[model samples]
Target chain A: MPPSPVAVSAALNVVEVAAVLAFAISGLLVAADKKLDAVGVCIVAGLTAFGGGTVRDVLLDRRPFFWVERPQWLWGVLLLCVAAMLVLRARHFAVTRKAILWPDALGLGLFTANGTQAAIDLNLPAVVCVLMGVITSVFGGVLRDVVCNDVPEAFSDHRPYAICSFVGAWALIAAEAAGWSLWASLLVATALTASLRLAAVHMNISIPPWDAGGGGK
Target chain B: MPPSPVAVSAALNVVEVAAVLAFAISGLLVAADKKLDAVGVCIVAGLTAFGGGTVRDVLLDRRPFFWVERPQWLWGVLLLCVAAMLVLRARHFAVTRKAILWPDALGLGLFTANGTQAAIDLNLPAVVCVLMGVITSVFGGVLRDVVCNDVPEAFSDHRPYAICSFVGAWALIAAEAAGWSLWASLLVATALTASLRLAAVHMNISIPPWDAGGGGK
Candidate 1:
């Protein structure tokens, strides 16, 4: 027999809360690692937590943004930031937006896999699904850096940020095409993205900026 | 007599093209005024044309973002950029992000009115309506500045950009409440917001940044 609708909803709610917390912690970790001001920290935390999912929901035409539907959870995000700050400070984590490279890479992998999986579930077009995955994983950190007044590290750091997520999204598609189990596909994609990001960072991989033009304007 | 569905659709497509052109021209005006790089100019133009509506669509769960639905318009945006660039080049307008303040003010009002009207049509909550208005008017510039690697002048320029739009959104609500016609309400809101923005810019009105805290981090 199938689970009751209420039971499924309850389980989904638990998963969502856990996902939000995880995403928030990644932001908090980045904030802790960076030298962002208190306001910057809060903005990064909030954007990191909600930005990607919000974009996905909007693209999919899902109503009542998760954050909007449960505004109380926002307070939870704030408190989590406070708690993360206290703990990270106690542990003497380096704090600066630059530290974003670490946790952001992990987030890139997780969100890329999750977003791609979501679009796949919806049976969206292949290109659209891949784009959604990329948007979900990359947009949050982009917002984080934008608000913090930096060229988004995802775009400009001479790094392979979006590329890693892009590849990871494709990996999910490949995995499913190969008849992999859903859980296995998700894990493989996430791990592949995260590990690739880590490898890129550790190896100091680079991508050049675009060429300048007439009047360079 | 009621128009045929095809007739109405054709008319809407025409209106959409006109609106897109107007929005694109506003961005071109800003790019023409500012001393931005070529890439910056293109980014600004594209964002100005599509940013707000894309955001609003996402929030309202409207599907196939206008640009997405009709990818051809994207090429039009690119061509528009090219044409605007040449015309502005021969005419010799100031070129710098600073030029953003002018056309941006006009966009603020127009998008604010349009966004608010869209939300009002949906019968969303009042606060949500106001926010949608603000997002539609302000988000494009935010994206433009972010991509240009400048702190969004909308937030950091010590200006009343968002606030002006905010008030304009409310004005639309009030106009509707007072039984104004839709066109009248839209015009009133747009004119009010744009003029307010102009006033703020002309006066160099400012808002202070948040106070720094422990570690100033």
Candidate 2:
């Protein structure tokens, strides 16, 4: 049987909360690495956690941002930043490429699902919805990397990161087109994206960097 | 006597156009320096020219982004990028710190006035209006630097960049509060900001970086 609406709403909430925490942690890691002040650290963390949603809302012309709607998310990020700062040693703080990928994959899936669903609910064009999904999953990391003075790995890493979200969004669209229920579509898309990301990394799969002559990255 | 409403509107239009052109050129120059493709150059240029205004509109929950409202801007940027690519050599593409400052100061001033007026029209709180103005003036450069894999000079570089915009925005607010005409308020704010930025640059004045205990930028 299809999941009840109440169960689905609860699941969606859990997924969103988890995704925000994951993105916030990722941002704080980079900010702390930069040796920024506490205020700077929290600011960067907040940006990373909220950047995608803000962009999505902006593009859709929606009002009262997600954080504004649930102000607790702001406190949650602040608390998380403080706790992580206290607990993480330099050793624990050491973030390898692989180390960043796991949580990123999971967050990517979760965010993409949420973003695509939001656009789809508005009956937007499929392409627009997919792009929104990709933007939602990828832009936070882009903001994080950009603030840290690095080229966004989403654009530069030659990994299948955004492409995974793109495909996952398409999957959700396809599931809905095929008459699947809302929760089922979201879960399937999320699972596909996260697993696909993990598999790509495990196998060292990559995308071709933009062929910007011989000089570009 | 205060300027006629028609003249004021015309002047505001001129300022907005000039500011966008200036910023777009700034972005294209940096992207070309990196040997980005034609598409990349155009994208960067568009982001730099439009980023701040987009942020403002997003923050205010405004519909139909400026570019969307004026689709011709998309074409204008594309044409400008292509023309620039044809006319400029690698030597011309070389941008010094000083080189980026002049047009930037002008754009900062122009955008700040427009942005502040926008928020003031909506009767937002003074602080919110001022911040909106700052974001409108400063975010384009922030976006440009971020895309180029550099930390935003606004947040780093120990320069009195955003602060200048802040003061300029307040100037606009102050003028309006003093019962100045709308156009007069805008010009006063713009002139104050652009001149202040030039004066600061000429004098080698800078803001102190965040005290990251000898670690951060």
The C-alpha lDDT values of all candidates are 0.71, 0.80
User: Residue A135 lDDT in model 2?
Assistant: 92
Q: Provide the TM-score, chain A, model 1.
A: 0.78
The worst-scoring run of ten residues by lDDT in candidate 2 chain A lies at A89-98
**What would the per-residue lDDT of candidate 2 be over residues A39-155, giving only the tens digit for each residue?**
456657878888887788788876666665566787789788777666665655444334767777899999999889878867899999999999988999887777878778788
lDDT of 1 at A213: 39
Error of 1 at A174 (Å): 17
Cα TM-score of candidate 2? 0.60
Show the colliding residue pairs in model 2. Answer: none
Per-residue lDDT, model 2, residue A32, is 67
